[model samples]
Target chain A: MTKPLSTEVDALSARHPGVIDRPLTQRFLPFAVAFVLIAYVFGSLASFDVVRVLSGTRTDLVNLFFLDSYAYKVHAVRKLESPEFVLSLEGSRYAVYDERPAWLAVTGEETDIDLGSDGRVHIKGDTLEYYPKDEEVAYKIKFGPGLVPQLVEGVAPDWMRASDIQVDMRPSLFARIWITKSKIEIHRYFLGWENFWFDFDSPLNGKSFGEIASLAVSGERMDPAMANWQYIFFQFWNNQEWQHGEVYYALLQTVIMALVGTLVAGIIALPLAFAAAANINPVGVARFGIRRFFDFLRGIDTLIWSLIFIRAFGLGPLSGIFAIFFTDTGALGKLFSEAIENADRKQAEGIQATGASSIQKYRFGIFPQIMPVFISQLLYYMESNTRSATVIGALGAGGIGLKLLETMRTRQDWENTAYIIALIILVVIIMDNMSGWLRRKLIEGSN
Target chain B: MSAQVTLTQNPRLREIGDAYERLSRSRSLYTVLLIVVCAVIIIGGFMVADEANSGSFWGGLSSFFDYPADIITGTYAAGWGWFALVWSYLPFLVETINIAVLSTIIGFALGALLSFVASRNLVRNKLIVFCMRRVMDICRAFPELVIALVLVLSLGPTPLAAVIAVAFHTIGALAKLFSEVNENADMKPVDGLKSVGATWGQQMRFGVLPQVLPNFLSYGLLRLEINVRASAILGFVGAGGLGAELKKVVDWNYAADISAIIVLLVAAVIGIDYLSGWARRALIGKTGTI
Candidate 1:
């Protein structure tokens, strides 16, 4: 999109009606050629594989997807010294397993009974010991019997491995490994979508596929059917707890990289912009050299610069920042110099007639005219750089992209990948708003 | 009179002189930026120097620049490998081309419709234009990668999903441009068509569209080239393209392959660039500017 200039179609057309020159052939030949080539390519796809393009990708996906690539370390809880028993999982209460403590000497129902902290309740007929201390870590038990067999039968790639299971009320960044006698079975599904992997670990390996699968499946709803306008509102009307957190650290890294990079580059670019401008250097050769210098540096894409930086500095956030800074310097210099070139000559002339020096003329005349454009350009650069940082980070320069890459490629965490995307969108909105605000301020301030 | 003529006649001399004086005046700003640029160039120089120092890399690299020296002159058949390379790039190229072509077409098609809504002379509702523009703005604000990710989440990771995402952006950008073109178009034909009881669609069909079609085509061709580049980029988000292949090589640290891929990519870019230029020139005819 371009800023509209004052040239009117009315006046031009008024002078001539068929002014567009009716020669469609000369003007549309290339478009026709392009169209033909594109058509040919698509038409030929049925017969072609081109080394079966994206085959390795599919193989990689197959390898990484599902539970075959996963391992778990879990300890069975019932085998340990604890009284936490599984409950009816379908939001119900089943038969209670009770025991009387050995030292209690006596036990009774007080309606609201608090079995002493250090004591265990012993059942009259059963040998099971009910430790109230352990019972406080209550877990939902299931009445249903067949959860695992159903899942394994449902999908061949699907597997249910139950291991060390701690029943921590809260979840951590990664699914935690079990400790001591607590056992956990993870319901991990690997899907091709965003390299998706989800794990539902619990203290109980509830009876069948339905009981466990219900817990896992019921968490997040990603069905495409929900995207329809009629259904979209219904789906989000009650935002599930599964809608993961945004504004994580990786996003912050990307934002910081863009801001710090462009600003640093701007600070470094102001002088070069002046030198490159045709107005500044009287010697044509020197001016030409400065101009070419800016071009040569900027011609290299930002991502390539990032790759180079990574190689030079080794893998880290530092390399990413350096890449952004280096590329922005050259690019911003070119933009700033162009702004300078397009400044009003009259203002500079006015300064010249006053017997002002070179620096004085630029300070008084050039700066005032070009500052607004400079800020506008700066705003654009900052906006563009946010996305660039994500790309560079994917190359292992450390950012949200690194998180995204690892999860997708190795961990196969599609849901988390979705969460990462949401975070990126949020940042983009924030950046857009910030750019708009800054542009308005710079324009108003200059005015 | 003579001094005035000299000043006017030698605009170049006056421009440079004035520029020099201005530079001298803004010494601090210019000096600082100068130092930064010099440092950047130095760093870039260092990278080149470092590359040169790698004996094998330089040797291979130097050999690469030799024009057709190792062309398979004999009856040596590199058929399958060559086929593999072409195949590897084929779908990617197709996807990229598809993204470019479809995006431009959809953008151009919908842009015309938006321009109709946005024309002040044709439509007087400021609120509608504002809402429409804002919607377009939001669409354009998103990078294609972000769009691909979101679509992959909502719609699944199909090529159709990618096409939709990119097309969404193209619609936004093209709509805005289309509105501008419509706004600047002559109102005489539109007024006459309206006076004759022509509907809004008819007026647009005959009155305004003819005036802006050439410019629209030119912009669309330019957008096509951009889409090709963008399609390549969407590979980073699993949208599927040449970028995915390039990414694999980079991740594997296959430096030779990386270099070759980049060369291919840049060559593709240049090819697209020239093709777009030809298209633009064709659209513009002998005009000085599009």
Candidate 2:
């Protein structure tokens, strides 16, 4: 049997010579030409500087952003009139010092910043000094009354950088000191986001989990009226830096926008889908017109719709929801009509035989068959639209997306941006799982 | 014997009828409750949204057609000048399409790699599959605009940023789909290859890939359609594309220019949809009903 099959295959190959016999050039030449053409087009049209991007020219910027996202800066500024140093995170008033970190010390007229192994930056009166761990000589800078900072002549080392208005010295990678006419400053770089849960002014700012747990169990109220746990919760909820409450509300708004948009779109699309369905409508022109109208709506895209709606509704969740609703109605209409056309006709015929009106036939017979498909599609769209709502929100529609964009625009608060991103990911994952579960349940349940 | 049969039959039939009636009554009650809840939620949500909006829904309802009318009138006033305006913005449109195409290609490549590793049928290690799946999930979770905005900060407002952002999302989406396709694929050829001592790569390339490529291509084309729209939106947030140009025109309140650009975008999207729809049907052999 195998021998005969092999012989038959060979005979068939023999009959179709071109199909079986391919020259090496014939096989590979087209691919080569296509590759060359793609390369040519990319080079000319994109004008992408492949070498520049690959050669690590932009690594510094990338590194700066990456480091900035995780690590925060400790800024200690001492003004000429003020003896005490003002400590802050990212120079934000919200994160200003209630008390300095353990490594920082401010006494009478002197401030000492111990930057771990990177050594120390000390400011005494009008003079600033950076003491490197590896080196014996300290880089010294003295500020004068003439609004100029002068590095002490022979004490200035190779790491010390001086300018007319400021004297800057880097004792190490982790520590820096700047002496200017108006103020003396030291900056210490540390890893990890600081004050994410609670700001400096909060009583619960630097408590460990164990400490917080103990506080929750037995400690006195931080505020006179509230319990210890309540105080902590309030502090974190109203956190000036992170604003967890506002973020949560924005997230809720985003989800609500998606839900409202998807549900409304589904509702609107049902009738429109029936109108577009060939068997239901029967009229070719009307069906054609309705289908083209859907195509137009879908082709307009959500961004353009949002832009147009913003003109009417102005900036809010309504515009975003409407944008999502309008675009998704078209998509859902197209999907739903196809499902309608594919529905089992015998059920509808049975209903029609019972002397039922057309509406009754559709309601009792047609809807039951396609309901599962419609629901599953709607759930899927809800999940996807949650993401789209974020994008729409960025265009001033309203939601966490607007917040994310606003945070991004600040170009500071990268940690907050990171937080927002994490929240979005969390929400999206939850929605994804929820939708998948619902789809499985609904579709499978119908069967 | 007749009296006993009548006595049993009457109670049994009555009980069955009562149970059926009870079940249906409860079911209808639940349905009514569900409908009521849905109606309340929808009405409440609409009210809240209306309140949040700058203009009331009723107030804005009348003026809903005003912007479209303005755009139409402005285009008509241009009297073929709209064509010139669209032509001038063609380069920007091309940039948008380039963003979509490049991102889709990059996404397809990454998604292919990820899908193979993530596929439970393909990968030997459960941990690797789990890790790859989560990575894809995280990638998919991020909105392209969010990623683009972040990238713009580090890379400036360049097309590359949009490409990376869009491609990142595409990888996640396509990987999930591709892995689903892989799961449904026939495993006999893979088993045959394995019996012959074929390597994993060889089995995948020769056995599985042939089965899944057409589906993957179809899905990829669909993704390309989505990415084009996404890339256009990314431009609104400062990533270079037709969206950015549209935003600029909108800011200047050049109604004709806005309408012209919108028309061109619609045309491009519709054209791509038709072309890709045709290609998909051709590749997939028109398997679906209707």
Candidate 3:
């Protein structure tokens, strides 16, 4: 009886394999194959040697960027004529300091630099000695004839490098020292942006918040021509290193470009949108032509438009504005026409029933329905266009973007780049928030 | 006598009519004022831009079509050679699209993660939401070209630089949009999963993801379209791609080449736009309509 039942079960299974009953491999094989094929294709196309690239990648540039962004190098150069030190940030002449940090001791004969537990570098006329904090042995570097830097044989360590014309000694992680043909220099790395507010030449340099507040209110005028507060304001505003004034102007130009472009585009697009809208424009060919015209304008990207406009207008904010206007006109025309086409016909018909003219029908009946969408989209474009204007400015259409690219090209001006980046970010965020707020207010208020 | 009686007795109706007229009058005045303000701003801005421009608007108007005419004639002169020129730059165009695709993929992955953290309805942690939102804002705030230029300076001019720069921006953009989508998701499914003792990730996967996937995919497609345009633009700033090639041709004054490259670029843009639109519609199941 059991043998017969088992054979029956086998017969039933073989005869009636259900539709849902399939082998797992059979079900998933196509997907698995597709997955593998896609992976293979991407792998071959990207040619990504992940492990090699990751391993071979150097952090030197990133380290430099980070170090340059927040930390600044203070250079104390030993003068040849006198034993005095000319201290400056990045060796800029405008940042020359009459005083020195507490860690630096400049005497008539010897200059001592404290590297804060790393080591001490002592310069005595024609000889220099670097004493590692943990070691007793001091590496002595001698200035040979013609002021060439020379290190004693077998005494130079791995951290300290020496050559005929220059000697670089890394006494600590935070500090470095160099001796060249003309001058001995010590670089002390400090955290935070150097001279962001007041330069070394300013009287307000190194002043605490409370001290600055007091000085602003009660202190004597730092400059004869101006009050203390006025002097501070002017100093910061006209800071030669940062050029905050020029930056502000560039920012203004960017905002203006975006605003003008967006508004003008909206104004131009409104009429063209009607021409593209099928319900508004009865002629099919005309509507098709206008739609394709918009598409052609849009198909040509803003970068191309800007490039062409730059040639015509000869590079300024105007070219950027025009580029934005032309491109946005295409986009806005399409968007606005869609909005118009989607509008309820009842109101328009009702206006027409009341013996209203076409313009009046649109203005009173159609405009109210699409106003919220139009305003919201216009605001959105204005915000995004602000960013686009920056990119256009990089192509020599004038804006903060030009300054940013220019500063970045100068390479060592990373701090200025950081400042400009910060300002741009702030402006963009403000614009974003402002547009959002305005959109909500206008839409809700109209409702 | 009947007209006098109706007029005197319906004083409330007359008052309402008077009030309506005054309101309409004030509204029309405001409208006129707004129009005037807009006109003034447009005119003033135009004047300022004209003054700041290197060439006057009137002078540029005459030569507005000069460059395009030159390009057309040049391309016409080249005849079938323009096609060959376009074909030659195809690889760079592919590189441009690849940069866009790679950036969009990376950006979508990272942005989705960030969006979950940034979404007010999803994340309970206030500080994480604040910090993540601000980080996205900063990322979005940076222009892709600026970042690309900086990266090129540090990392050398390479496609990788463009990819990274565009990716950074995409992350911010997609995160903001994704979070907005997440905000609108129904919470009942999430609550049901939570009642079943599902973990946070499980709840999100089994509940929210299913609901938001279509919208997310739609947004991602739109971002891809945008990223392609951005990557192309970024190439102009020395991050190597078709844009760099175009810049070279432009610098060398190759009018035929410029036209050919532009046609190719326009074609690529329009193709991507259509593909993305179709994909978005399919994902959202909103077919047969614009």
Candidate 4:
């Protein structure tokens, strides 16, 4: 009484026809896609030469980026001919210290360093000695002929690396000492950003937080003709090393660029969207032309637009705003037209029955229906354009992004780059949260 | 009809009418205030930007077409050589597309895994879901150029930097979107698989993935379109692609070359957009414009 499974399926397929006899293409489509994807992946891997890049990358630069971002190095440089030691951040003369810092003790020809658990470093004349905490022996680097520092005593520790010209002794992850006959440089690393609150030129540079707070509030004035708090505020805002005021202004400019760009784009697109909408435009040729125009606008990359604008407008946020506006108008126009096309026509018909003019009907019926979409889309673009503006700004339009590029170009200002990056992330996150919240409120209100 | 007429004439009706009028007046007042505030902000913002700019808007408007005009003339003069210029840029265009495609694939794979952990209903651990979401948010907050610029310094103008930058962004973006799709997936199959003693991974693989795969593919395709644009822009920062070529030409002030490169970029972008759009519709089994 039981038929074989294949014969029984055949019998069923004979009855149902197309239901059981699926096309070969239908069954093989997924496999075909998978095959193409896998082949492309392999082909790209070979063509991109990913292995060479991975091997060729300067790994130390990557490591330095992480180390340099949050921490700063204070270098104590002593010329071979002079006993006078110069202490400065990153060996920059502009940031030199007028008074001795607490970490180093100089007593005549000898000096002592408190390197924490890595033990003490004793510098006497041309000899640098690193005394390990557990070992009785000390590693000594002697500055010999031609100012070349050579390891002269004891087994060299793993942390100390020597070359023909200099010896680099890294006591800890953050601390390093470089010695040559020409100069002896001690780089002490500290956590947290230096000169963030006040640069070295400020009178309040080495003051404690409580002291600074008191200076801000108390009757004692740091400068004449200004209140103590005002002077403190001015000092902090205009800190030469940080440029906080300019950065904040640039950030504001970037945000304003996004806001203006989106708002103007939306304002212009709402009308053009009508011209492209199927129900409203009706005329096939005109609608097609408008639609293709939108595509043309959208097709040209914002980078190209900003570059062109930069040429005409010189270098500034105006170019950035124009670029964002031009690109977003095309995008918003397309979306708005789609929303218009999908809008329910029954309300418009009702308005027509009330003897309303076409414009009045669009305003009373269609506009209200699409208001939520328009608002939400504008807000969304505003957030995204904030990001785009940053990029455009990096491409020469003036903003925080331009400042970021400037710092990055310095090669040694990695800390400043990190600071700008952190600020960018903070502002972007804030915009995202604000846009989401506003979108919810606006959508609910529209309904 | 008599009752309706009496109701309209009642004191209570008048009170209701008065309240309604007050509400409507306040509402209209708010609307007008909002419109005025928006107008002022836009205008004020524009003025501030204009002041900060090197060239005034009105001053620049007259010269706006000067650059374009020059580019057009140059391109016209190049004649058939323009085709060669565009053709020469194809390899860089291919490099740009490769970065987008590879990053998309890698990001999709990583994002699929992260999305599972990030999904609230799928993952029972509240801390994991919270942490993963924040991680994704942080990753997404970073612009690709920021990462690419940093990497270019270390990697020396290689496409690998752009790839990693775009991939990092794609992972975060796709994870967020994929988790949203996961949230909408039917829970019954997962429950059924669990009751049959399936492990979490197996359950997710058999139950949840099948439900959300089509949408995942659709979003992945859409992300590919975005990444193409992103990678091209990343190339401008010395990450090596079509943008690098564009930047080179721009820096040299090669008008015809710039025009040709722009043409190629536009064509590639629009072509990819169409291809991805078509693929997405096919994958999702939907016809109307998104």
Q: Per-residue CA lDDT of candidate 1, range A1-447, in tens? A: 564444565566657855655368867886997797667546544323333443323543443232232322111122223333332111123321234323224334211112333223232211222232543432222211121111111111111233233222112211221222333221112222311221122122222546445534454443455533323333223223222222254566666667667777887889988888887766788778876666545544555566665555555555666678877787789778878887788998899899999889999889988888778877878886887777677765667767666656534444455567666767877887799897997588558
True contacts kept of each: 0.03, 0.55, 0.52, 0.70
Which rank order by lDDT, best down to worst? 4, 2, 3, 1
- Report the C-alpha displacement of residue A421, candidate 4, in angstroms: 0.3
Best by TM-score: 4
lDDT of 3 by residue, A247-284 (tens): 88888888888989999999999999988998899999
> Candidate 2: where is the Cα deviation over 4 Å?
A1-26, A29-41, A48-64, A80-83, A92-101, A106-111, A122-129, A133-160, A170-174, A202-234, A351-357, B1-37
- The per-residue C-alpha lDDT of model 1 at residue B178 equals 76
Docking class of 3: acceptable
Q: Sort by DockQ, best first.
A: 4, 2, 3, 1
Candidate 4's residue-wise lDDT over B55-137, tens digit each? 88998899999999999999999999999988888899999999999999989989999999999999999999999999899
- Tell me what TM-score chain A of model 3 achieves: 0.84
Off by over 4 Å in 1: A1-247, A282-292, A406-415, B1-108, B111-134, B147-165, B177-189, B210-229, B236-241, B267-290
- Best-matching candidate per lDDT: 4
Best by DockQ: 4
Model 2, span B1-290: residue lDDT tens: 98656755798866777798898898688779967876876777777777767777777778889999998888889898888998999998988998898889889978988999999999889999999999999888888977888777666677777888999999999999999999989999999999989999999998999899889989999999999999999999988889999989899988899998998899999999889989988988866421
lDDT of each: 0.57, 0.85, 0.84, 0.87
lDDT-superior candidate, 1 or 3: 3
Clashes of each: 43, 0, 0, 1
Cα lDDT tens digits, model 4, A1-447, are 565799899999999877777788886897998899889888887787878877888888877888889888888888878877888888887888888877789998899986666677898877889886777998888884476788889877788888777788886777778787688877777888998998788888888999988878885666888999888889889989888899999998898889988899899999999999999988999999988988888889789889888888889998888988888888899999989998999999999999999999999989998998898889888887788788888998889889889999988878888989999999999999999898998789757
State, as a TM-score between 0 and 1, how close model 3 is to the true structure: 0.88
